[model samples]
Target: MTPTVQSLDHLVLTVADLNVTLAFYTEVLGMRAERFTPADGSQRWALRFGSQKINLHQAGAEFLPKAARPTTGSADLCFLSDTPLADWQAHLDALKISPEEGPVRRSGAEGPILSLYLRDPDGTLIELSNRL
Candidate 1:
């Protein structure tokens, strides 16, 4: 019998600049930032959003045994937001970050959603969506 897979816990992101990425995630996107030193003695950072998190490894400073093809601008992640898409658009406007595409209707894990797409500091595609 196959074991059922639950929700995602975390994922790793390889970034070009840690500080810029952290600022975007914490200040603009409003996620919580955390720093830690792993067993390999390398310091790493993560941004926590709701129950999930994204661990950040600097481009050339990754801990051993990481993704074989970790690259900047490779992630395209969608995050569910409690705020309405209109409000999120205003928030992005206030932050001076332009949306790449959307308030477009799209399919989500649970149901139909309206999403706003933008790029992070390292050009990772980020989608902020609200359930319809």
Candidate 2:
């Protein structure tokens, strides 16, 4: 039998500052901050948008079975936007967050994507794109 990879449901991000990370995702990127309690009686945080989420693990306090070398500023993530890239740029500009790169052409999983690249507080390269 062959095992197949279905899709991405979530990923973990180890962060230095929880509040700053939360604010960047929730306030700046329009994700929702949510708190969840695992069966082990521990509280955890996640940033939810659409059907996907990023679980936030505090540095030095990550849960069991984490990445081998979990560290801040190690993630380069891309998000597909429902809105136009120009509007996303405006949103970023209004927040006074300057992009490190462009709204240029890039190849995405589905098709061609027009993208803007920026860094989160953790220095993770965040790509916001719209499929063309």
In model 1, residue pairs whose N, Cα or C atoms come closer than 3 Å (at least 3 residues apart or on different chains), thus clashing, are: none
Q: How close is candidate 1 to the true structure, as a TM-score?
A: 0.94
**Using lDDT as the measure, which candidate wins?**
2
Stretches of candidate 2 off by over 4 Å are none
**Full-model lDDT for every candidate:** 0.90, 0.94
Tens-place lDDT per residue, model 1, 17-111, is 99999999999889999997778787779999888889998898777788998899999999998999888889889988799999899999999
Model 2: what TM-score?
A: 0.97
Clash tally for model 1: 0
Each prediction's TM-score against the native?
0.94, 0.97
